[model samples]
Target chain A: MKMIAAQALVKALEHEEVTTVFGYPGAANAPIYDALSKSTIKHILTRHEQGAAHAASGYARVTRKVGVCMATSGPGATNLITGIATAYMDSIPLIAITGQVSSEMIGRDVFQEVDITGATAPFCKHNYLIKSAKDIPKVIREAFHIASTGRPGPVLIDVPIDLQLEEIDFQYSKGPDIRGYKPTYKGHALQIKKIVEAIAESARPVICAGGGVITSNATAELTELVEGLGIPVATTLMGIGAIPVPHPLCLGMLGSHGVRAANLAVAKSDLLIVIGARAGDRATGQTDKFARQAKIVHIDIDPAEIGKNLGTNIPVVGDAKIILQQLLNYVDEHYKEKHYKTQWISTITQWKNAKPTNNIKEDGNNEQYVNPKYALSVLSEVTKGETIVVTEVGQNQIWAANYYQTVYPGGFLTSGGLGTMGYGLPAAIGAKVGSPEKTVIAIAGDGSFQMSMQELGTMKQWDIHIKIILFNNYRLGMVRELQKMKYQMNYFAVTLEGSPDFVKLASAYDIPGEKITNNSKVKEALDRALSYQGPYLLEFIVDPEESTL
Target chain B: MAKHTLSVLVENHAGVLSRVAGLFSRRGFNIDSLAVGVTEDPNVSRMTIVVDGDDYTVEQVTKQLNKLIDVIKIRQLNPSDSVARELALIKVTANSSTRPEIIQIVDIFRAKIVDVSKNTLTIEMTGVADKIAAFEEMLKQFGIKEMVRTGMIAIERGNQVIKIGSSEESE
Candidate 1:
């Protein structure tokens, strides 16, 4: 049976069980749109290609499925780069399909022609440029497999206009068997036993969980291991919500911006079992000083990451979920003798209790601006640590990460690696779409919120009921503080002086919004926004001189 | 710091070269020399990469190269157990007065004069990288006009081989 590549593409998506796609259309992908219209898949027309990409990322994170996004050639594909890079950095599984000019016109520099595959090669996990319609089904299958497996990241498929119009014999292929693309899922038994012995020998053992816990859905296994072993857990910025913050064993995030106690725990440990984290500079501070006293056991799916940043004494290269489960089993079976970490826990507890971690507390008497931390604490309190908090980078992100206190697995989403601004609003829309039962809130600083403010139209048009919490500091708060700390307070190009009244801007989209000026009204304002049935925006006036800590 | 040679087996495709080269440049790993050619298996390609790095850097380079989807396998070729060769073409400025001396030097190196004009002689030599460099250095006194080199290529001696599914011998 013969079918157009566009029709076969839609069929391929159906075979993969893709229920929704975030996209922006043009002449290049008009045939795909036409085919998509006849299928059961839901199409979300984002205001910009960037929004579509981010929204797909959000959807992927919440659904734990490969997010799909599409855009036309040139500028449309270029616009998806930041979001692609953002997904790549965080290891979100995504498939970005872009339309190119006709096959012959690709190299001729015709209208709307860009080498998107080459442009995204540095960032994307893999990419393909389709030359034949017959290869669509196999390529799509491979793209999905590659995007979702190993260290999940974005995969790009560039289809030319002529290929989409070409008729080919259609047959959906089986799962990919690329010889060179095998991902080791089962860990070595000897390495697992070694980790157990190291755990049993240490007086001060700490587990550093990274984004891999969430990516591999190993949160349950991790929580079990942490609880069973009575070992303290410190998470990277990307590792938030891997173990609930309320858990006594949880020491919160560990990094430059991480909690002081978590950092101390990692530094003082005799043995550190690092799972699924790269231990990047931000997380490790200075690599030599990071966990200097500890014998590190690094467990990760990617072999390259095991000893990339920090030296590893015992390296287990496999999926985190499997390895953690193996550790759990080994502990349950033969590890009868338990090492006491009472002094270690008490020491960490004392450090956590010490008030200097958050030295800049709300003075309570300030009437002009809201304490952003205090406001987020209220949001956490009112929501009962139940909301999916997607935060834009800057002061707002750090505040949310510290204060939100996510209780469930995968409850927090942010651009931890890339630290992309304007990520929250669109991501919140995607999360809400993916998980309709949960309340999703996008927390953004004033400067970051306006980066993708046009996404308000996407929410309004799709009726996505995501709450937007914009912290109005009237300046690029994070950069201003950076200048104050490092550049001798020479503030230039950091102020949002010409920014619009965000509340009024939301009103123009007919979304109800409120503006609060002080900490006293934070809970009431958040409660109001969360209680509203439709989309809502709540703006809080934060102090211009507010410190992140 | 130290020089190491890695023989990588990759799927034969247009993008595989870029993917391997891009990984090196992106990761800040410096490649001193690289040579790629089709293997006995038509679908497989072999790449010999000579890099300057310490043990840590070599480990990282091998691991990073293995990460690319096109790369099938990698083996760090030990100098004692492997045979390495490089081919270089030297275009030396040759006049009637200098021709005999250059030819004698070429004869000693067992190099062939592949192309010759009245003004220059292009000598093709196949040997170890150091030997080729030494030959080039000897000819530099004669005012060589131009040169090209196919970096380096190596294979295991004594029946040991580098091929797909032969990853146990890799670093």
Candidate 2:
């Protein structure tokens, strides 16, 4: 049947089983909005295009599907850049649609026209500029495929205005057929053999799993592999959900903010088997010194990542699930009752036992201000395992990473790669939208919260029941900490002298707000925020001297 | 580390070469050498990259190259029976100082002087990577002031394109 390009977009999205989209309508994208009105897809009108992209990110993270966001050309599309880059850095699957000028007016710099495809090329996984209506169906399908497939990331489709109005026969296709876009999911037999050989020969081996495992839904496979081999597992921040925190073999998160034992374990391991992680700088501090003692067996779907950061002695290029399955097969073939050396396990166990202990004095009578770590411990104990936690960059993010115990998969969301501030509030709103049944809380520092605090209106407008817990240290706490540690305490721009009262700021948005000066009020504020039916904010005047991480 | 041949198709535009070469240097992936030339597509140029890495790394580099917007396609050519060559132009002092010695060395290497002035002789030579490196080293002894080389480019000796999904045929 002949249909408009905009109609084809809706049809292709329907084929992808996308039920909802988040976006704001503009003149350039009016055709798309009009077509969406006729389709079954639900479009959530966002206060800002950035919010739309971030909300889509949250939705995608929860559903493990490509979250769709739309905007018009020019500023409408540019607004989504930050959110798109956020998803790109985090490896979240997102499909961003934008309207463009007519093909005839493209090079003439028509009103509301921007070269969005070119603008987003460096950040996007892939992008397409639709010149003809006939290509809309194929382009949309390819966008979804590229965004959600191996090494998932944001993909953009810039639809020209004329094409959107043009009619074409648009039968929705279910797959992509570009000759150059095949992604490998199965491990090569020889590479798998080499990995198995390396594992068998190593006396001390540890597995470093990343978010790809969760993206591939290979948690069970990873758990089985590690448990079967009796090897310890350390996860990147994005890899939090790959293994249950309760599992004895799981070594929480590994990085600068990682568990002390996990970091030390990586430092001492004889063999490091990295799966689905690029070994990003944050995860591997001082790259030259990272895992210096270990021979690395890097497994990933993207082959370029093998030697991009650190050289891999054995590289397996395939999907995490398929590679794990192959390794399991190899292990079964070379079955041995005692694969792990007992001494290695015992040594690691001893290190784990000596891990840092959290102690909070019950009296709380000290004249000095509360430690952020202690506050985090208290929050962790109160929030327990049921609440979803979102953190801003800097001290608050580090504190949450170190203290918050995420008992559930996909429970923790933060800007790990980009480390963007103001990510907490909008992302938390998205997370709440994605999982409305859960209690979502965002932990933000004074500086970071102010970056995207305008999103509080979004939460209010959407009636999202997310708790905003602002650690009001009256400064950019992370930068301050860095100054003290590295810059010899010469605080320059890190100080926030005349900050607005967060309680008043939260009230400006007509959201219920509170300020807690005493540690005794933390639990009560937390309880009130959690119990509040709508959005709520609690500003805690944390001591500036306290180290959050 | 094993040598691998990569064929990359990129947009024929300025600064693309710098960006592409810069990526290699930053990554520290030792490119033994590379060759580039215009392909059948007038707008697209092909680069044959010879690097030392395993199969997985080679495939990865190719994928990354393809990811570049300027780059259209990339394929790994088989090492066996592939012709690899490089071209180098050397400017040497050709006055009474070292004119005879430079000519003798250039003649021995079967090189040609593409440009000649009263005081300078510019010799152009094309050969494999080792030969180019050797020629440059030999010319350094004769007070060589400047040298330029087009990196190595290669193609299979037979009529074989670096077709996709030809894993069985590669070996």
TM per model? 0.98, 0.84
lDDT of 1: 0.90
How many clashing pairs per prediction, in order?
A: 0, 5
Model 1: DockQ vs. true structure: 0.76
Question: lDDT of each prediction vs. the true structure?
Answer: 0.90, 0.80
Interface RMSD of each: 1.0, 4.5
The per-candidate TM-score of the B chain, in the order shown, comes to 0.95, 0.74
Which pairs of residues collide in model 1?
A: none
| CAPRI rating of model 2 | incorrect
lDDT of 1 by residue, A246-274 (tens): 77888988889888889899989999999
Best by DockQ: 1
Interface C-alpha RMSD, model 1: 1.0
Q: For residues B44-163, could you state the per-residue lDDT of candidate 2 as single tens digits?
A: 788888888887667667767765546666767755677777788889877877888888888999999899888889999999878877888888776687988887788777656654
RMSD of each: 1.8, 5.2
Instruction: Write the residue-wise lDDT of candidate 2 on A506-545 in tens digits.
Output: 8888888988777766677777787788888887777888
